[model samples]
Target: MTDILIRNIDDDDLRHIDALAAELGISRSELLRRETKDLARRHALQQVTLDDIRRSVDLAQGVLDEDLMKQAWG
Candidate 1:
């Protein structure tokens, strides 16, 4: 794998990462890798949810507006 450098990390953030790494019994780099993967996965899931919402909105657009209002008020 290629090496990536992350710069400008705050001291407090670094300390937090270090603490988590110690707690997890892993190196800081390993902890960072795991966290990054988790973040990416969550982001992908959110995108999928947003896409589903968009599709629902688009489908609703074709439905009768009066029906929607009646449903909303009822």
Candidate 2:
């Protein structure tokens, strides 16, 4: 596997990474590797901000409802 080094990481940023790794019960390197891969995969997708999501959801307002319940359940 290729190695990537992130330089000049701030103390707080490192602390956050350490905390996240502890939370996930993994080494910081492992957590960073998994996160990096996930980010790489996600980077290829269309990026949507919170505003975009809100707008899309607003556009879809009241669209999904109990209408499909009959077909799904009965």
Candidate 3:
């Protein structure tokens, strides 16, 4: 496996990372690895386009009425 080195992290952020790692009963490296994987997965999932939105709307076959908008806002 490839290793990663992050430099110049703030002391406070390092403390925060340690705290989170402690909370989850894992080492700081493991916490960072898990978080980095989740971040990459979410970034990959966010690749949407106008055509994708149009296709989703077409598949839904639903209208965006005021009631639906109000519910969404709430």
Against the true structure, whose lDDT is highest? 3
Error of 3 at 70 (Å): 20
- Which residue segments of model 1 deviate by more than 4 Å? 49-74
Task: Give model 3's clash tally.
Answer: 0
Q: How well does candidate 2 score on lDDT at residue 16?
A: 96
Q: What digit string (tens of lDDT, one per residue) describes model 1 on residues 1-74? A: 66789999999999999999999999999999998899989997776577798989997893678878789878
lDDT of 1 at 33: 91
lDDT of 2 by residue, 23-74 (tens): 9999999999998889988996667799889999997865566776556577
For residues 1-74, write the lDDT of model 3, one tens digit per residue.
Answer: 89989899999999999999999999999999999999999998899999999999897753557787677688
Pairs in steric clash, model 1: none
Candidate 1 or 3, higher TM-score? Answer: 3
Clashing pairs in 2: none
Candidate 3, TM-score vs. the true structure?
0.70
Per-residue lDDT of 4 in model 1: 83
Q: Against the unseen true structure, what C-alpha lDDT does each candidate score?
A: 0.88, 0.87, 0.91
Q: Give the better candidate number (2 or 3) by lDDT.
A: 3
Window of ten residues with lowest summed lDDT in model 3: 60-69
Query: Every model's Cα RMSD, please?
Result: 4.7, 7.2, 5.5
